[model samples]
Target: MKKLIYLLFFSFLTSCSSFSEYSKETKKGFDEEDRTMVSNEAANLKTITFGDFKFATSQKEFRKLNKQKPQFKEILFYAKTTDVPYEYYVLHNPKEVIKNESFTYKDTIIGNSRFVIAVSKNAPRQDSEFIKKMVLSLR
Candidate 1:
């Protein structure tokens, strides 16, 4: 009984820490300015696709596609609630696949629509700029 209780506590602590890390990284994926600029861009889209991956697709389908793609490394996958509910994925390419050290991919589902955003490590400002451009292009 003691061993089972200890195992449960340990698991709880680790999961909490993992969520903290995910929340931190998700915040890093974008910023207030980007949010401000792209405020309504996503509102009108029925489908969002980036490369071969489409956002808001079934999680099972996504995993299958990711498995077929050799270059991408899936970092994390989780669901969270902000103003609305969404599923978020963090992914990266192997060093050989992308020469840049700071590159990262953030795929998410906002409501029923899927969206993908790319960010450079430690570059939240650039994240805002990139989203600004993406918003413009989407419109």
Candidate 2:
């Protein structure tokens, strides 16, 4: 009788531990799915706009359109005299920009305006088409 009870107890403990592991795995799956959904939604956004300010709007125009000062980090700047043809600035918010395989956001200033470009980091580095499109989109 004692041996039977011990066997039953061991079986119950094993089942409980298995169930705990299963629950953990199920929760992990759900979390991954949630992240994927959020990523997809972010990817679907084709335009970048902050309040009334939009990509390709001149700095002066931007100031007039937005009442509040916008926050961003400057990544690069190029002078008009340079071979680049346009005086540009690159800016980004490290917190909002995704550095992963999903996407990356870059703000490029050309002439007197700033342009926002989002590209998949996983894309081929040699692909100039995306850059051309972004530059052409600037007014």
Candidate 3:
């Protein structure tokens, strides 16, 4: 009876440890692809300041539009109506509004729903020249 109890306890302990290890691995995998900032290579960056939130650099301001662009293709944001200082917000497709994890950034606060139009992350990051141009075009 004593040996049987010991075996059961050991088995339970091993199982708990294995479960934790598996959880850790899964979390790591999620973060590997989970990004919240666009890469520094997207093209067509146009700088239009809105309110107190000033995105000075075209590249820096891109983040204001798309939190984390995984590639050159489109990104999306649900913004407030008062967010953008220009008419570009009218260009967003109502259907393309993606699921933002309940985030309200400076851009969104102004009322512009954000979205990208480039190709998806199908090409190399270095070759994502499209993104780079967006960053550089903003004057």
Candidate 4:
């Protein structure tokens, strides 16, 4: 919780981002692996009801990854809110998330953990901005 807060706050310090080249990195997949169908999970996890931001549920179509160490990894959760033209992966690590604006949205923040969001090259700014807030505010 503390780490997530820090990351959200940390994103505001940068004046400009250099990771624009890798902006599309999240949209590509490994050729070595077979393509998996994208799905949504609206029934599995009990969602704490929010106002109008009833984002999509966690579906199997989404992929999740994390470290195996208990001390190294605290709590990790993966979800995406499709409120915009792209998908912003809301990854929550109880410990740390690697802070990299290059691999993330401008308004979005990263800590010492793995955070990935899927968005099209022509996604809208409003959609991208809202997704970040939804992820960070999710409790």
lDDT of each: 0.33, 0.30, 0.28, 0.31
Q: Write the per-residue lDDT of candidate 1 for residues 2-113, one digit (tens) a residue.
A: 9999999998864432111122222112233333221233232222212222231233434443433222232222222222222233332212224344445545554544
lDDT of 3 by residue, 1-139 (tens): 9999999999886443101111111110111334222222122223221222222122233455545432221322111112322111111223344433332112221123343333223333432342223322312
TM-score of candidate 4 relative to the true fold = 0.28
RMSD per model, one decimal: 13.6, 21.9, 17.9, 16.8
Q: Per-residue error at 19 for model 3, in Å? A: 49
Local error of candidate 1 at residue 54 (angstroms)? 5.4
Model 1 TM-score is 0.24
TM-score for each model = 0.24, 0.22, 0.19, 0.28
Using TM-score as the measure, name the better of candidate 2 and candidate 4.
4
Best by TM-score: 4
Error of 2 at 83 (Å): 33
Please give the distance, in angstroms, between residue 38's alpha carbon in candidate 3 and its true position after superposition. Answer: 19
Candidate 1 lDDT score at position 80? 22
TM-score for candidate 3, residues paired by index: 0.19
lDDT per residue (tens digit) for residues 30-136 in model 4: 12234221221311111121222222222222223212211111222233334442333333332344443423542233433333343334446655454444332
* Model 1: residue 36 alpha-carbon error in angstroms: 22
Displacement of residue 111 (Cα, Å) in model 4 is 14
User: What lDDT would candidate 2 get against the real structure?
Assistant: 0.30
